[model samples]
Target: MDDGKLARMRQWMLTEIAVETACVREQIGKAQLDPQVMDVMGEVPRHVFVPAAFQAEAYLNQPVPIGCGKTISQPFIVALMTDLLDIHSTDSVLEIGTGLGYQTAVLSRLARQVYSVERLAGLAREARQRLDSLGYANIQTRVGDGYLGWPEHAPFDRIMVTAAPPQLPPALLDQLRNGGRMVLPVGPHDHQALMLVRKDAQGQSSTRVVLPVRFSALEEGEAADLF
Candidate 1:
């Protein structure tokens, strides 16, 4: 799309999907988010991450399926998690699932580096290509099981898991840097909560439940011995 076309589409997205109501605005303000986060949330083209058939509903403030039985998270949820991370420009982020790369694209604008993992090879390839085409050089995607977390690039400043795990995986905690924060959906597939785990400077971790949510379950490995 040309610059003018893209600009017009973005405006439509902001008007139709960006949460501009007084109540949501108040909630965002109360969340203590950086002003830039709101700006970026409004600007990113969410429709592009959805399938072409669902483009019209891309900015509807609800989750939309993006193939592979996975859905892109609601915009508010994305904003909430991003705000909670308190990311700085130099922060290195680890994203557990890349779904359609919409959230990854959003994080690419906010963080210095993003390493995302997707279980489905097709989804991973598509996300990588889409991000690259959009000039998002900060995001690196790999096809793998997110349950193990990415170990080679341990000690991430922030880690966001897109799927809900039955329980918090120890590997994820181990990969977090001291003082880092991880935002993930925890619980059963039918019922879950968005939980934020923060590791203090002394390596002690604390968890706080942020909101009720539901997502696909984190996949387990084929090897019986692997946890």
Candidate 2:
């Protein structure tokens, strides 16, 4: 996208459509995401991550189909979750559900390290290529079940799960560092809540419901069979 075209698109987002998306605006303020997060949301070429057919509606502040029965979250939702995680420049973040890597790109800008997992090998491969082409050197993508989280890189400073689980995964809790925060969607497909979980220095954890939301169910695995 050319600089002039990008500028016009961003102007449309900040001035035109932002007001219509009430949930987006509410979440942005409630989550306390950096004002710059909105700027990044405006700047990123969301259309490129989606099918060419949907490019026209990419900046509409709504989810658009991206094939594989998956859809990228709305721009504001991405920003809200990123904000809830409270990322620091030196922190390492673990992200579940790579989807199209748009969220991964946003996280890369705020954190020192990012480890993203995608259940589908095809999606993981494609997202890796896209992020690599965009020169996001800080992001590392792996093809695997996100349910188990990434044990090899346990104790991440922050964790964000894009897909909603019936309940937060215990494995994810184990992977978070003390004092770390995690943002996730929890509940069924038809109804859900965006949640923030924090682990204190004493290893105690607590959860707070941030907003109503919905996402794809977290996949089960061999580990789940044990339950």
Candidate 3:
């Protein structure tokens, strides 16, 4: 696709996201979304992350299936999660469930580096290639059980999990640097809440439910390991 078409799509996408942000504020009774978060939502080309057939609906305020029964999250959720992290350009982020790497791409702009883990080989490969082609060199992807996180790169400054786990993974919490923040959905498959976990500089952790959310279960077991 030409740059012109993509630019137009982005403009249309920004308009829709702005509306969604307002509705989100009204629902939660907040004033407005963080400006930086909204800027990233507008800039990332969501159209490049999903299957070509779904590209036309990429910017809509809903998750789009990205094959393997996984999804690229809705813009509002993405913006909310990113905003919660309060990332700085010097921060290193650990991202679980890479999905199609849309979140990874967004993080690339706000963080120094992003370490992403995905169990599906095809999805991991595709996300890596897409990010590379798009000139995002700050993201590194690995195929593994995201439940374990990337321990070798422990002590991340921020952690973002893209799938819902039955509970918070201990390894992820342990890997978070003191004073780091983690955002993830946790609960039963059908019901969940976006929980923000914060580890203070003193190493004490606390959690708060930010919003109700529904997401696919984070994959595991033999089938998840196969690819």
lDDT of 1 by residue, 54-160 (tens): 88777667799887778998776787788778888999999998988999998989999999988887778778777877888888888788988889988899999
Assess the local accuracy of residue 158 in candidate 3 as a C-alpha lDDT between 0 and 100: 99
> Model 3, range 201-224, lDDT digits (tens) per residue?
899999988878999988664325
Residue 68 CA error for candidate 3 (Å)?
0.9
Mark the regions of model 3 whose C-alpha exceeds 4 Å error after superposition: 1-5, 26-29, 222-227
TM-score of 3: 0.92
Please list the C-alpha lDDT of all candidates, in the order they appear: 0.81, 0.82, 0.86
How many clashing residue pairs appear in each of the predictions shown?
0, 0, 1
Instruction: Give lDDT tens digits, candidate 2, residues 1-227.
Output: 67687667667765543454454555445423467666677766776777778877777678988777889987767877887787888999999999878898988888899999988777777787788888889998887778899999988999999999999999999999999999999999898999999999999999988789978787875322110
Please report the candidate that would top lDDT against the real structure: 3
Badly placed stretches (over 4 Å) of model 2 are 15-32, 222-227
lDDT: worst 10-residue window of model 2: 218-227
The TM-scores, one per candidate, come to: 0.87, 0.89, 0.92
- lDDT over C-alpha atoms for residue 48 of model 3: 86
For model 2 the local lDDT of residue 54 reads 86
lDDT of 1 at 69: 76
Q: Residue 151 lDDT in model 2? A: 97
